[model samples]
Target: MDDLLSGLRMPERVAPGALFLPGYAASIEREALRGIAAICALAPPHHLLTPGGRRLSVAMTGCGAFGWHSDRAGYRYVSRDPVSGRPWPAMPRSWRDLAREAAERAGYPGFEPQSCLVNRYDTGARMGLHRDCDEDDLTSPVVSVSFGVTAAFLFGGAERHDPVRKLAVESGDVLVWGGPSRLAYHGVAPLPRRTHSLTGPLRWNLTFRRVTHRQGP
Candidate 1:
């Protein structure tokens, strides 16, 4: 596995533990897109309102052992989909394999993500800087895959006031961050209005996480 990954080329270390593998997901783009369609069909994505009652621009859904959710109540992981009132669809094998491989290539081996958050961003949609801390196991890394239009990704330090490093993430790119950078504040800048043959004027982001800490529904 190491040899194969090495042949693919070394990944750029964006931070202490954050590695960026450009075009790492290109080979399986078609399969991953199909899996996204299947998962979305089962649990349609929808914009969620925050605890502050502000609606998020990104529409989202999830699949795996748990689904990340936020609402007027709070943010946490739930075993069932808040929309369908059913268990989130099982994680696609292809998706899981890609995530595990990407994580391992980024230096975090033995990563078993139990949750995959699928987020869809339309033109003008943006995610605010925030830390992903709901998961119990901080030891495991978060693997993110981008599809469709390119966007600027902001990676910052532990404090919100810390300077942020902006990086452009293109389709088929994989990013993994864990260990010291697991709780770093990060977010996506507002997407520019544009169209891509594969996704039109939208971008799809898949975030894989191991939600070892399960909360009651």
Candidate 2:
């Protein structure tokens, strides 16, 4: 797959501090998917309740030291799986290396992500525009890797009412945003009923974040 990524073009700047990397994860897709499956085996994916009591359409799970969670209390990161009551599966080295390399390529170097929120979007599932503010280390970019079916990614400014740009994200694509765009509102549009050779009818996303200011580089 390294040969597959070699012919790709340079990263496209989507905003002041946001870059869209086409097929950035092509080389590691199989390993990443296997890692995600292993993580899910230990910590099953489930829809989380929003602070408003609404249930998210996307099923969520994670790996790494911290996993992003949402409940009646609100969105936050926890060291253990809320369901299994065990530590989230350790983040795979390939995942960490890919995230770090992607962030560095996007101009945010030394991004040591402590949380990797894995979201599974079945057909018709969609995420509302929102900022990732739970993490204290806002300087580190959010490195999002997409696999499986294609979906529309909505990237917006800081405010909820700001204009949004829709981008088609296919399997193996990566999007990194931070710096001025760290607080940008972003979400996934409703996934169309479709199939990918690798993931069948689902779209998988691995979102890497630096959850705290104290974590090492």
Candidate 1 structure quality by residue, lDDT tens digits, 52-101: 99899999998998998999999999999989899999998888999999
Per-residue lDDT of model 2, residues 26-55, tens digit only? 989888889889888899999999889999
The 10-residue segment of model 1 with minimum total lDDT is 2-11
Could you tell me which 10 consecutive residues in candidate 2 have the lowest summed lDDT?
1-10
- Candidate 1 yields a Cα-based lDDT of 0.90
Report the Cα RMSD per candidate: 4.7, 3.5
Candidate 2, residue 106: Cα displacement in angstroms equals 0.3
> Could you tell me the TM-score of candidate 2?
0.94
Each candidate structure's count of clashing pairs = 0, 0
Off by over 4 Å in 1: 1-10, 213-217
For each candidate, the alpha-carbon lDDT, in order, equals 0.90, 0.92
Clashing pairs in 1: none
Output the lDDT of residue 158, model 1: 84
Instruction: For residue 142, give model 1's deviation from the true position in Å.
Output: 0.4
TM-score of each: 0.92, 0.94
